[model samples]
Target: MRSNCLPFRADSAAATAEFVRPQRYALRASHSIARCSGLIAAVMLAGCMSAPPSIDAPTTRASTAAIDLPLADPSAGVDMSLPAQRPESLPSNSALARDFMELSFSLESGRAIPQFSRFEGPITVSLGAGAPASAPRELARLVSRLRGEAGVPISVGASAQNHIQIDFVPRKQMSREVPNAACFVVPNVSGWDDYRAARRTARGDWTQVKQRVSATVFIPAEATPQEVRDCLHEETSQALGPLNDLYRLPNSVWNDDNFHTVLTRYDMIQLRATYAAELHSGMSAPEVQAKLPAVFARLNPAGGAVRGLRDDPTPRAYVSAVNRAIGPGNTGARRAAAMSAINLAAAQGWNDTRAAFGWFALGRLSVQNDPETALNAFAKAGNIYRATPGAGIQSAHVDMQLAAFALSAGRAQDAIALVNRAMTPALSGENAALMATLYFIRAEAYDTLGNPAQAQQARVDSAQWARYGFGSDAAVRARAAEVAALARAGRG
Candidate 1:
């Protein structure tokens, strides 16, 4: 078990200020089956709420404010912006290959498939009748990305014989049925009804199928556009490619960190490898593994055979502890669990990102009960992340938390410093939510410093990103009010 892989939601493994309930990873099992599905949940933190993620976790926050700010002019509508295109950095091929094998051959629960499977021909996708109004537009965008990025031959809105059926159901009904799962994908199922009947049986199991012909992905119809997009990216990738989610993957959306919400460059590379002409459906896991190096060599020749970041396997005890700490429970029990997770990390003598997560968990849970402890935990987590390669974005999440605290304590300079340091990673990572939150923090900091011009500018900058990150004008305003409230708290 990897501590970084928080299933569904809960825990600030991703960088969210508040610890929320972890979204349950949906599963299909039997004594003999090929594999389970991707058990990770695609969780959103609305606009400014960026989470360390680890999963769909809504974990701990030290201080939560809900004060309403002054009303803005209604003439200025909510703003939204698409992230700019950036160059893709390749991790070591060794890491990619490892990620590829684990993600391809197993589920998030570590269930294995004896053989590799994929569609032999072009894939067609269709929207269910119940899909949200935004389904067509989002689907088209996703399709375009798939074609341009992944080189996967996929088209949306196919009228006849669709290979992938995406259904948008009421979030309430879906949530009730799959309590822990925000959304899910299953094999040999084309509709919600089909999935309901076969959910627990081999009929819906990925391992049961030797060749992929059809699958269904259930999403929340009424969810915000961002939420729908996140869900689509996670489940659609699984429906067409890997059925597994790995906690160790630092870049790809295949990890449960839920820090990443879109199909990333790394994700595309894997998909490209999966659909390579040399490889076909029904190949064994070993066979696929053997072919990946050559496949990666052709796909990413720049990625030399260098050793990637040293990764450690997360222990079951630590994972359970972190989960219990972040998941729903009494305060005392939750705090104890968070401490256990921290202790387990220390005992393991690990120095990877996973250990940092334990500290992050502790800091998050301590915010309300023990500010000193929370501060210490965040600092420790930040220090460890700074030393860890590829953890800049992860560390930014912690910085956001600290910045909020700083603002609440009236330490405007400290808050600005934290936000400034984190801005680069937040931008590079294309995390609109984190970016907006950082801007909000900056705005408050500038205001506190008597720099009204800078404060106004910061607010202006936060607008477009906030719309995309938070979904609606109301949500963006809510986040803005919350930031202002932080300052008010310090003054009070």
Candidate 2:
């Protein structure tokens, strides 16, 4: 649920000023399935308006008189050659401070936004309908991670007074769950575009007493395992607090650049700082700033500095190219645009990571029509990513794509092999959707090979992995039917 902050297109200061309230904020993150080019257009058009001339402007006679009067230069007291004055020192490292400010405040709406209201006691979280089968385990794992890193009493279990509910639903269900509220002014924040809405119950004078959070996260039924994991890490973390997205943050899931998909050490520090006992639910920026130093000191007594602030060097052209290719509109034109941009990027020698994404996009677009070419493209991407540190996860994603293509080509045995290769323990633990889909595919493969016993077992495994509320039985049956039909047609 990340979005880029595009400039508001207003004809007058008054119009822009009037936009302060009721402004929606979106996270700018990778939307692997949903297309957002039209969202960009909508934001531009919706914010633009014609404005009349100001009533306080001088009349013609007054302007003439003012022109006739002698006036001093506007820059008279300022020395243009001298260096500008440096502002007050930040509370943390320079990059962290800058990113913290951006994440803590809505520059467009002039709001001193705070994190989600905190609980005084242990936090109990529950999973709702549409949650993945692996939700319970993964959420328990995340709860442990948060408890260890932020020293919060957060746990996942069923309770009468659960503080938070996380729902992992399909894209269609998500659209209904996450209404396009007027508060969401920005568009195309994330693919699947999940959202979190929190309510704070407070006593007199805005003193918060209780908090409840309802978060809806979308996992595309067909999304790859890695994409599912990224969505889980980000949407779930954001639900706890730190709702804002800052592109400037180099190594955090809170950044929209999609550079670092998982939560980083820096992110943990921020969470620790936010949930520090000294800070309250409704503290002002200055108050929080006054306390951050002590919080950081206590958390990092060894002076472990915040790291990974270097911005992604991926060119905009490459990003746009990949987006257009994957987007769901104007297929011919968008693919052409993507190819053109990829060519230009290659000519100029772009980063390997960006190139890998570009090739991945091309592979995605080619899978249905040209399986061989798509496999080659995915293999190239996998090879390129394999050389990078902590990028085995990305390479596994490529393998998942390859497996999907293999399944589409009716090569059930090959698809099963690829799926097995991609289903690493880390990935399986993090993504219930991926585990469900893997089992579903395995079921289909077994059915194709006339192994009904194994196929039924696989179906049970799929449902188990998908949990109870995510339409596991129906989705698995539908996918199996589709694959069977494809195999019968011999279209691959």
Candidate 3:
């Protein structure tokens, strides 16, 4: 109930901007933006196209002569450098932020256990009625230390009868927990009658003990598993001890089922990708289908439905589902549920947005198997976000997602047009940063369309936009290699 512990509204959050704290903290951290390798890689990674689509005819542009402008050299003003900026230090609430970031990431990447392999939960102390006034301060230090040591935060809340309740904030929707009664027992806490009653009932019940804590993690529903994962890890590390412990943690504390459930959908998506790759290489679709079910079975129970297979028993199911619903198609519930698992994985301090996005891409692929439907789905997702304020989604980002979908569906014109429309100042910031991203999307679309000169121009525009977004020449210059690769491919 603290004033500073504000509720986050998804619709109001800016996607392309970072929130910089006013006072700098002396902390060190490392992160890498994953690069997409191909269809499989893209599915597992964030900001990737949904699926493959055939390239279509060019739509008529307004006019070439009217749009004439000098194209700058891609090399002249590029920034290809990685700057080492000092991390901001925290004074009071620093522990919470740092641990939340780390545990979140580890969860998303399927490496949660390894990341939090050495955390020792705090020795919780309970106070009776009229205990010293130092309880709250001591509790705060414990919370901070746990956050600093585990690189994850502990959520503090009012016990049922006014007693203070403390527990780790889960990184994902699903996570494993140890038996609370025996593992970390606290005695009678003072001034909270309701809490005492609840604790009396929870003394031997692990499930009930967990229920005492609220699900207070800050991850949004729309957050990709990877983002949630990274945030948890960063935050967890920030909360742990002054010294670090990277190995030799607890075994009785581990929960494999919890881990497996969260990653099930992603594993299925990867299996599908592997199957598709095998077919693309030389194997037949039927052969891939025959072998793929085994992978699916591994994810599901002994006699249940396959965890991540999207296509119906036959391709007809997908086609019929799409034909029946022109508006938004079916909800990818299973895929979404799987993505939710990242919250738990994140508790251990891993970041893996790629895997989360990949799962979503698979769900999208199932509902919209073709270009038109996929485009509509992206548009619908945007609309869904716009209509709901705290839905934890950004409508603007839908533009980028639509472009990726168009590229995969071979609808170059659609992709290009969407980017162009979204590039308007009224619609977005349209500054160098946004313009740079738009240009990149446009270039990808143009390259897909077999327009070399236009693609080259788009690349140059992209570099300019990058300059505006990053404010660093080194960063923009590094994009040259990608531009050159696209040019070479387009030429071929």
Q: What is the TM-score of each candidate against the true structure?
A: 0.79, 0.50, 0.28
Better of 1 and 3 by TM-score: 1
Candidate 2, residues 268-316, lDDT tens digits: the string is 6677766678876656666666665566667666543544333333345
Global CA lDDT computed for model 3: 0.31
Would you give me the overall lDDT of model 1?
0.65
After superposition, the stretches of candidate 1 with alpha carbons farther than 4 Å from their true spots are 1-86, 159-162, 305-312
Error of 2 at 167 (Å): 10
Report the lDDT tens digits of candidate 1 across residue range 159-259: 34338888888767776776546678888876787788997899988878788888888876655555566778889989889887654556667765565
Model 2, position 323, has a per-residue lDDT of 49
Q: What is the lDDT of residue 82 in candidate 1?
A: 32
Q: Name the lDDT value of residue 124 in candidate 3.
A: 28
Off by over 4 Å in 3: 1-377, 386-393, 425-435, 447-454, 464-492
lDDT of candidate model 2 versus the reference: 0.45
Model 2 worst lDDT window (10 residues): 5-14
lDDT of 3 by residue, 1-492 (tens): 001110010011132222111111001000011111133112211221111112221222212311232333422332322235332222111222222223222322123222111112222223333322333343454355444432332344443432222322232321122211111222222323333354546443222221122211222222222222222322222222111111111110111111110111222233223322222222333444444445334422233443333321112222222222211233454334333432332343422221222222333443323333333434444444444322121333445455444444444565576565555421222233334555665676676677868876776555444533333343333333332233232333
Question: In each prediction, how many residue pairs overlap at the backbone (N, C-alpha, C within less than 3 A)?
Answer: 34, 12, 85
Cα error, residue 197 of model 2, in Å, equals 14
